[model samples]
Target: MQLAQLLIFLILFPLIAAFFLFLAKRDLDRAWIVKLSALTIGIVSVYLLISTYDKGGLMVSGIPAEPTGMIMFILEMLIALAILYLGIVHKKWLVVALIIIQSAVMLYFELVYAHAIHVQSNLFIDEFSNILALIIGIIGSLICVYSLGYMKFFHEHHPEMPDRRPWFFAVMFVFIAAMFGLVFSNNLLWVYFFWEVTTLCSFLLIGYTKTEEATNNAFLALWMNLLGGIAFAVAIVYLAMFGNGIMGLDELLASGKIIALIPAALIGFAGLTKAAQLPFSSWLVGAMVAPTPVSALLHSSTMVKAGVYIIVRLAPIFQSTFTGYLIAMVGALTFLIASGIAISQSNAKRVLAYSTIANLGLIVACAGIGTYEAIWAAILLIVFHAISKSLLFLSVGTVEHRIKSREIDDMNGLIVRMPKIAAMMVIGMAGMFLAPFGMLISKWAAIRAFMDAPYGFVFVIILVFGSAMTLFFWAKWMGKIIAVTSDGKNIEGEVDHSEWAALVSLAGLSLITTLVFPLLSTKLLEPFLMENYGHVAQLSQDNIIIMMMMLMLLVILPLSILIPTRKHRHVSPYMSGRTTTHDMRFSGSLGVQKKTVLSSYYLTEYFGEMKLKTAGIWLCSALIGIMFVATALQGVIL
Candidate 1:
C-alpha cells in the first residue's frame, strides 16, 4: 500500500478499533480487539519508517481539505459543547470560560483570517515525525495490550466501582489516534483540533472513577491543557493577522524570529503548559490519581510529548533570541527544582512524575539552545525518555498490583519476593540514569551541546546539580528493589501474561536501543541533521569504545551480586529505643511503630513538596510574565 493510504489507516484504524472495543464489553473480546489493532498499527508504522527513512519532508496530499475542515470545525464545536455542558453542570466556571474564549478566537480566525489562505502542505513527514510515529504506534500499542490485564485486575479489586473497562479501552485507542493525527498535521488548525481531542480524552480517562478527587484532577488537567489551547488559538490568530498569513507550523517557523517571535513565544508558552513545566507541573503530578496506564500514556508517548515535539520543531527560531532565553531559563529552573522535589517523594508514582517533568525541562532547554548539537541531544532525550519512562511506569504499576503498595518502603526485598519483576524494574531504573544507558548518554550529549551554546556555564551548572538529584532518587528506589527482606515471599506468579509481555518487551527495547544507538545516529539522526541543519553531531570513537566498556560494566555489576562470597555476620542496625534483633526493625518513642522500621531520609524540611513547588511556581510565573513583557517591548521597538 502507498504511504498516504497507510498513514490514513494508522490514524483511523485505532478509532475504528475503539468503537468495536466499546461495543464488545467482554474481557476476552476487548483483549483480542486491542491486540489485533495494536499489532496492525505497529506493523504499519514500521512499514512507514522503512519506506520513508531516507526521505526528507514528504508533503502529504490527496485529502480534500475543504470538506475535512468543515467536518473538523463541527467536531471541535461539539467538543466545546460537551465541555461547556460539563462545566456548567459541575460549576467549574474556569473550564467554561476557557472553552468560550478559545472558541471565539478560533471561530473568528476561521471566518476571517483563514478563509482565503492556502497551505502548500497540510501534512508532512520527515525522519523526526517518523521516529515519533514509531514511538506512539509501538510503545502506545504495548501499553494498550498491557491495560487489558491491568483493567481486569482493577475491576476485580474494586468491585464497588462500576466496570468501565470498555470506555477505558476505547479512550486509550482514541488517544493514540489523536497523537498520530497531531504529529502528522502540518497545518496549525488541524494540529490544534487534534490537540484538543487529546485533552478531552485525557480528561475522560483521568476522571474514569467519577470520585471527587479524580474529577478534580481530571479537571485540573483539563483546565491546564485548555489554557494552552487558548494560547494556541490566540497564536493562530496572531500569525494569520500579522505573520504574513502564516497558518502552517512550517511557515511560522520558517519566517524566522523577525516574524515568529511573539507568536512563537505564545506557542512555546502553550508547549510549556502541556509539557507540565514548573507552575503547570502540578496537573501532571495530580494526574497520578488515575490508573497507572493513564499515567504512562500521558507522560511518556502522547500528551506531554506533543508539547516538546512542537517546541523542538521550533528550535531554529528560538536560537539567540530573548524569547529563546526565556524558554531556556524556565526549562533550566524547572529541571533543577523538579529534580530536588523528586528527592522528597516516597510514592513511586510521584517520583516518576517529577522525574518526567525534570527530563522534559532538560529537553526544552536543549531546544531553546537551538544548536545542531542541542537539537540532537533533545531528540535523543525524547526517544530515551519515552522508552525508559514507559518501562518504569508500567513496571511500577505491575509491582503495585503484586505488592499492594506504591510506597518506596513497601518494596523491601522485592528481589526476594518477585525476582523477575524486580530485575525488570531495576533494568528500567538503570536505563534512567546509569552509565551506558540511553538517558545518561543523552544527558552527556546535552551537556556537550550546552557547553558551546549561549550562557553555557549556567546550563552546565543546572544540569550537573539536577542530574545529581536524579541519581539520588533513582538509586534510592533501586536500592529498595534489590534489597533482600526475610519476610517477603515470592509472588511473581500473580502477574498476568499481558502485563509481563509489555514490561519485558519495553525492558528489552530499552537495552537494544542503547546498544544500537550509534547505528541509529548514523542512519537516522545524522542524515536528518545533515539535511536540515547542514551539520552533524557525533561522539568520538574513543567515547563510543568507553561507552561499550561501561555497557559491559552494567552487565557485570548486576551478575556480580550473585557470585559466591565469604559469609559475613549480619548485624542489626542500632536504634536509640527498643529494637528488634537482626530484623531491620526498631521501636522508638514519638509514635514509632512496635516494629523497627528504617525509612529513606526524605529531608522534607529542606526539600518539601509544598515549599519547593510554591517557590518554583512563583519564580517560573515571574519568568513567564517577563517573557511576554519582553516580547511586547520588542514588538513595539521593531
Candidate 2:
C-alpha cells in the first residue's frame, strides 16, 4: 500500500474498528474485538513505519489549508461554549472566567492577526515520529490487550451495571488515532486539532465510571487542559500573524527567528499542563481513580507523551530563550517535588502515578535543555519508561484484583500469594529503579546535561535529592513484598491464564530489553538520534560496564537465584523494640494487643490540595500573563 494511505490507515484503523465493535455490542466477544483492534492498529503502525523508512517524509493534499483553519476556529468556539455551559451548570466561576477570557483572546487573534498560512508537508515522518509511532503502537496495543483481561474482570466485579466496554474501547481507539495524528502532523494547526481531540477523549475516559469522584476528576482534567488549549491557540494565532505562512515544524525551526520568549513560553506552558508538570501534576495523580488500564495507557504510555513530544519538537526553536531556561527549571523542580510526594504515599497506584509524573518531568527537563545529548536521553527515557511503567501498573492491578486492596501494607507478602505477578513486579521495578536500565541511564544523561548548563545547577540538587526519594519508596515496597517467612506454606502461586499471558509478555519484555540494552541503544535509538538531532555520542563501553555493575548491585545479581534458597524465619516488623505475631499490630500492656494500621504518610497539612490549589492557579495564571505581555511587546518591536 502507498505510504500516505498506510499512514491514514494507521491513524484511522482503531477508530474504524471501534465503531464496528461498539455497534456489534452483545453479538461480539469484547476481548476478541479489543485484541483484534489492537493487533490491527499495531500492524498498520509497523507497516507505516517500514514504508516511510527511507523516504525523507510525505505530505497529504486532501485537507485544504484555509478550510482546516476555519474548521479549527469553529471547533474551538464550540468547545469553549461547551466548557462555558459546564462552568455555568456546575457554578464554577473560575472556569467561566478562564474560558471566557481565553475565548475572547482567541477570537481577537484570529480576526486581527492571522495572515497567509500554508504548509506543503501535511504528513511528515522523521526519526522522532517513528519513535512516537512505535511507542503509541506497541505500548498502546499491549495496554489494550491487558485491558481486555482487565475490563472483563472489572465488569464481573461490578456486574450490576450495564457493560460500557463498547463505548470504552471505541473512545480508546479514537484516543490512539488522535495521538497518531498528533505525532505525524507537520503543521502546527493539525497538531493542535489532534491535541484537542486527545483532551476530549481523556475527558470522556476519565468520566467513564460516572461516579462523583470520576466526574469531578474528569472536569478537573478538562479545565486544566483547556488552559493549555488556550495557550496553544494564542501561540498559533501569533505565529501565523508574524511567522508569515511558516506553520510546518521543519520550516519554523530553520527560520531561526527568535521572537519574544513568551509566545514560545506559552507553547511550553501548554506542554507543562499536558505533561502534568508540578502543580498541574495533580490531575494525573487523580486520574488513578479511573480504571487501571486507563492509567496504564494514558498516564504511562501515550497521552502524557504528546506533551513532551511537543516540547522536544520545539526544543531548537526555544533553545536560546530565557523562557527555555525557565522551562528546564520547571521540569527539574517538578521531578523533585513529585518524587518527594511519591515517597509519602503507600497507595500503590498513587505511588506509581507520582513516579510517572517525576519521570515525565525529567524527560521534559531534558527536552528543555535542547542539547543533542539531552534530547536523546528524553527519547530513550520515553521508550523505557513506557514499557516498564505500563507493565508495573498492569501487574499491580492484577495483584489488587486478587487482594482487594491497593495498599502496600496489605501487599506485604505478595510474593507468597502471587509469585509470578510478584516476579514480574520485581523485574518491572528493577527496570525502572536499577542502574544500567534505560531510566537510570537517561537520568544520568539528564544530570550530565544539567551540569553542562551554566544556570541549571540548582536543578542538579533537586534532581539528585528527588531520585533518592524515589528509590526509597520503591525499595520499601519491594522489600516488604519479598519479606522472608519461615513457614513452608508461605509461597502459594496461582493465577488465571489470561492474566498470566499479559503479565508474562510484559515481564519478559522488561527483562529481555535490559539484557540487550547495548544493542538497542546502538542500533535503533542511536541511529534515530543521529538522523534527527544531528549529533551523536559514543555509547561508551566503560559507561555501560559501570551501569552494569550498578545494576548488579541494585537489581540483577541480587535477583539472580542461586542455590534454591530456603525461607528465612518470619519476624514482626520493628516497632519500638516490641515483638508480636500480628503482622501490623504490636503487643501492649499485659499482652493486650491493639491492631496498629499503617496508612501512607500523606503530608496534607503542608502539601494538601487546599494549600497548593490557590498557589498553582496563581502561578499558572501569572505565567500565562507573562506570555501575552511578551508577545505584545515583541509585536510592537517587530
Candidate 3:
C-alpha cells in the first residue's frame, strides 16, 4: 500500500470502528466489534512499522492542503464550542474564559495571519512517529481489550450508575484515532487540531462517571489543557507572523537556528502543561477517579505521550538555548519531587500516576538537552515506559476489582490471594525500576546523556536521587505483592479471559523488549539518531553483556519460584515465648488474644504530598516564568 493510503487508513479506521461500537447494542456484538477493531489496528500498525523500516520514512505533501486546513479549522471551532457549553453547564467560569480567549486567538490567526502560511508537507512520518504509532496501536489496543472485562466489573460495582459503556468505548477509540493523527501530522495547525481532540476526549472520559468529583476533575483538566492550547495558538501566530511564515514541523526544524526563541518557549510551555509537570500535575493525580482503562490510556500511550511527543519533536529548536535550560530544569525538578511524593502514596493508582509524571519529566529533560544521546534516551524511555506502565495499571485494576480496594495496605499477601495477578504485578514493577528492565536501561542511558550535557553535574545528581526514590517506592510495592504468609485462597478463575489475555501479553512484552534491547537499539534507536541528528551515540558492549546477565537472572529467578521444590516443615514466628501455634498470634498480659500485623512504611511525614506539593509547584512555576522571560528577552535582542 502507498504511504498516503496507509496514513488515511490509520487516521480514519478507528473513527469508523468507534461509530460501529457506539451503535452496537448487545454485549456480544460490542465484544466482537471491539476485538475486530483492535485486531485490525494492531495488524495495520505492525505493517506500518515494517513498511517504514523498509522505506526509511515517508512524506506525503502538496495535495489537499487548502481543504485540509479548512476542515481542521472547522473541527477545532466545533471542539471549542463544545467545551464552552460544558463549562457553562458546569458553572466553570475559568474554563469558559480560557476557551473563549484561546478560540479568539486561534480565529484571528487562522483568518488573518495564517493566510501566508503554506504547509508544503501536511504529513510526515519518520522513526519517531513510527515508534509512537506502534505504542498507540499495540498498547492502546490491548488496553481497549482489557477494558472489555474491566468495564463489566465497573458497571457491576456501580449498579446505581447508568451504563455509559457505548460512550466509553466510542471515546476510547476516538482517542486512539486522534493520537495517530497527532503523531503523523506535519502541519502545526493540524497538530493543534488533533491536540485539542485529545483534550476533549480526555474531558469526556474523565467525567464519564458524571459525579461531582469526576466533573470537577474533568473541568480542571480541561482548563489546564486549554492553557496549553492557548500557548499553542500563540506559537502558530508567532511562527506565521515573525518566523518566515513557516508552520510545518519540517520547515521549522530545518530552519531552527534562525527561528525565534519565543515560539519555541511557548510550545515548550504547552508540552509541560500537557505532560502534567508540577503546578499542572494535580489533574493527572485526580484522573485516578476515572476507570482503570482510562488511567492506563492516559498515562501510558495516548494523552500524556502527545505532550512529550510535541516537545521531543521540537528538541532541535530549543537545544542549548535559555529556553532549553529552563525546560531541563523544570523536568528534572518535577522528576525529583514527584518521585519523592510517590513515596508517601498508599493508593496504588496514585502511585502509578506520580510515577508516570516523573518518567515523563525525565523524557522532557532529555528533549530539552537535545543531543543525539539524549534523544536516544528519550525515545527509549517513551517506548519502555509505555509498555511497562500499561501493564502496571492493568494489573492494579484487576487487583482492585478482586480485592475491592486500591490501597497498598489492603493488598497484604496478594501473592497468596491472586497469584496470577500478583506475579504479573511483580513483573510489571520489576520492569519499572529493577535492572535488566527496559525502564532502568533507559534511565541509565539518560544519566549518561545528562553527564555529558551542559548541566551535567546538577542533572546527574538529580537523576541519582530521583532514581533512588523510585527504587524505594517500587520496591515497597513489590514487597507487598510478593510477601507470602500462607497459601491463601486462589482467584485464578475469577478474572475474565479478556483481562488475562491483555495482562499476560503485556507482561510478556515488558520482558521481551528487555531481552531484545540490543537489537532494538541497533535497528530503531541508532538509525533514528543517525538519520535525524547525523550521529549515533554508541552503547558500550560491556553494558550489553551486563544486560544479558541480568536477563539470565530474570529468567532463572522466576523459574526458581514457580518450579516445584522439596516439601519442608513450616513453623510460626517466635514472639518471645508468647506466640500462638495456629495463626501466629501473641498472648497479651491481660490474656487477650492478638493477631500480628505488618504494613509497608509509606514515610508520609517526610515525603507527603502536603509537605512537598506547594514547594514543588511554586519552584516549577518560577522556573516556567523565568523561561518565558528569558525567551522574551532573547526575542527583543534578536
By TM-score rank, best first, the candidates go: 3, 1, 2
Question: Please, what are the lDDT tens digits per residue for candidate 1 over residues 1-638?
Answer: 88777778888999999999999977788889999999999999999999997887788877657878778999999999999999999999999999999899989988997777777777888888898998999999999999988888988998989998888999999999999999988888888899999999989998998989999999999999999999999988888888878887778867867788888888888899999998899899989999999999998889999999989988888888777888888999999999999999999999999999999999999998888898999999999999999998998998898888999999887877877777777888898999899889888899999999877999999999999999999998888878765656689888999999999899889888888889888888888789778999988899889988888778655454444267634566556546655556566577475665547878899899999999999999999999899987877676
Report the error of model 2 at residue 384, Å: 1.4
Superposing every Cα of model 1 onto the true structure, what RMSD results?
Answer: 2.6
- Among all windows of 10 consecutive residues in model 3, the one with the lowest summed lDDT is 555-564
> How many residue pairs clash in all the candidates, one count each?
2, 0, 0
Q: What is residue 615's positional error in candidate 1, in angstroms?
A: 0.9
Task: For each candidate in the order shown, give its overall lDDT on alpha carbons.
Answer: 0.88, 0.75, 0.89
Colliding residue pairs in candidate 2: none
Encode model 3's per-residue lDDT on 1-638: one tens digit a residue.
98888888999999999999899877888899999999999999989888878455567865567887888899889989999998898899999999999999999998887677888789978888888998999999999999999999889989988898998999999999999999999888889899999999999999999999999999999999999999999999988888888888888788755575688788888889899998899989989899999999999999999999998988887777878878988999999999999999999999999999999999999999988888899999999999989999999999999889999988888977987788888888888888888888888889888988876889999999999999999998888877765556887688998999899899889889888889888888788788788889777899899889988898665454455387734567677888575665778879788887778888888998977889999999999998888888877776
- Write the residue-wise lDDT of candidate 2 on 1-638 in tens digits: 86667767877787887787777666247667777877787787777767766554455656566776788679878977887897798777777888897889778866776555668777777667887897788778788777776777788898875688889888887888889989988778778888888888887788888888887898888888878988887877767766665667777667664553445667778888899986688789778888888898887556798999999887875564555656776677677767777776768998899889889888888887777777878888888898899889998888888888998888765666666667778878878877767788778877787787767677688789878878877888887666543232433243445566667777777666666777766655566667666777556889778766765575443244222368545656776887656446778889888775544445566555444445654564565456456545654664
lDDT of 3: 0.89
